[model samples]
Target: MPIYIAIFCVLPLLAGLIPEYLVCRFTRRKWWKVLPPLAVAAITALVTAGRLSVWESDVSPVTQLLFVPGVPAAFALLGTLLGWRLWKRLWGPRVVKDRRGG
Candidate 1:
């Protein structure tokens, strides 16, 4: 039970942190920063849905590996949002000062 919780809940959230930081750090545009992670989440949801819809007795190894539970994606979304907030706080837009006394 504990292991299941850790794998499904804790690990994904932690896994998500890096991608978000990298995205925020590398991407200059606001849209660019957000698009990648959302695309990941969307892809995961689609895959999960497709797998669930098709009833199969023999699941492929690839499919099994790719079979990500929805919880992880949700947690990851939360993690990305947190990362964005942190980035905004740390390296967000700054107010430029006038060269001469205004």
Candidate 2:
């Protein structure tokens, strides 16, 4: 599989944890609130770097410009942002209410 595709497939599993971990380490906020953006940024950077590496040997400047790094980076950034937003919308405000009367 292409590196970008492989990265995309694997990112949800790996990148999903990034924001939570970062929040836990840096601040005390819960995972749901902070994870998505961090995950997306990490995935974008990784994808961009991978694309650059894959296209570094191309001879044509136009091919290099079109296929090298920018497009994948942009896609990864947008994908990550969308993924984060979806995750937030689905599970962002999950406060557990106490059932017993005080």
Candidate 3:
């Protein structure tokens, strides 16, 4: 019971994280950050809709299925923003060293 719930929650996150991280690593960049994650969530929701009932998605008022996948996008957005923030903080400026010393 709990295991299924865990899988349901984690599946979207993993699906979002892995690809976004890979893109980040290679490009060292983000595409409006949240957009990519949102895309991931949308696709995941669409693909898994068959496995999940409308009730599972829309009922319970808390475990809404439609929005579940977007949870991953929030994390992904946070990661992307944080990554860019850190990168800018660490490397956004140029360091100058005097070429000529007396």
Candidate 4:
């Protein structure tokens, strides 16, 4: 169960975080911010749906609908948010010191 959570949730979160951070940091385009979570959501949904169709699953439908894909997708969005923050910290305008001591 824990392993499943790690594979499904944490992996996607990292997958979303690293690339999004790098791209946004370099490109600094607001539009590029949308890609990671969207990709993660689509991939996670498809993988979860595939798992359900192929196996004798024990998880409930509500759990399937809500948690299986939802948690990972949410993590992905979170990664995007964190990535944006990191990019801002790295590349955003710096406050220059006043040498005249005004």
Candidate 5:
């Protein structure tokens, strides 16, 4: 149970990081901007996969619709929003002073 919880928690983070790293390494675009959507997508994918794999034998419609995707989707949204806030705080704006002729 703990292992399952751990896997659920970590998989989305890993999935989020993969796209961030790829964008940073391969393209000129800022990786931070892409993280939120990617994180959400990744979390969704992970949750869906986990549900299908773990409960395929004993699946029911309610479990299929609610438990399998709902929690992770919520987590993904929260995580992405948090990540975006952090990214903004960390990398947003710049202070520059005007240099005028003396």
Candidate 6:
């Protein structure tokens, strides 16, 4: 049985998270959250374009030039969330009181 599910999920999640984590660590800023998804989206777009641009492919000329193969923001956001959740779980989440009564 192929472990394609795990492989695909883990790789993109890490790729999306690492840069975001590092930037947040160094800058200690909340705005750094934007970086992860945007970076991942850019990477996805570039890779898609690169693959489509190869010879003998039927990719549209506009797609090759504009690199608009697919939108990664949605997937990127999902990956970012998953990565953060995994990281937090590994490190142990901090104890915080909930304002809402449970």
Best by lDDT: 4
Kindly list the per-residue Cα lDDT of model 3 for residues 1-102, writing each as its tens digit.
776555555554455555555555556445644555667556656745654665545456344644554454455455545554655565567788888984
Instruction: Say which prediction, candidate 1 or candidate 3, comes out ahead on lDDT.
Output: 1
* Candidate 1, poorest ten consecutive residues by summed lDDT: 60-69
Off by over 4 Å in 5: 17-58, 94-102
Off by over 4 Å in 1: 54-68, 93-102
Q: Give the poorly placed runs of model 4, Cα more than 4 Å off.
A: 44-59, 96-101
Clashes of each: 0, 0, 1, 0, 0, 0
Model 6 spans with C-alpha error above 4 angstroms:
54-76, 83-102
Clashing pairs in 1: none
Model 6 clashing residue pairs (backbone): none
**Which candidate leads the pack in TM-score?**
4
For residues 24-62, write the lDDT of model 5, one tens digit per residue. Answer: 445556655576576577757876777665555665756
For model 6 the local lDDT of residue 94 reads 81
Q: In candidate 2, how many Å is residue 92 off?
A: 2.3
lDDT-superior candidate, 1 or 6: 1
What's the ranking of the predictions by lDDT, best on top? 4, 1, 5, 6, 3, 2
TM-score of each model, paired residue for residue: 0.63, 0.37, 0.41, 0.68, 0.47, 0.49
Alpha-carbon local distance difference test for all models: 0.72, 0.54, 0.55, 0.76, 0.59, 0.59
Write model 1 residue lDDT over 1-102, tens digit each, in one string: 999778877777766766787789888777877675777677677777776744464656455544365667777777777777777788888898889977
Residue-level lDDT of model 6, residues 27-83, one tens digit each, is 656677677877776777777757665545676565554323343334456768765
Q: How many backbone clashes does candidate 4 have?
A: 0
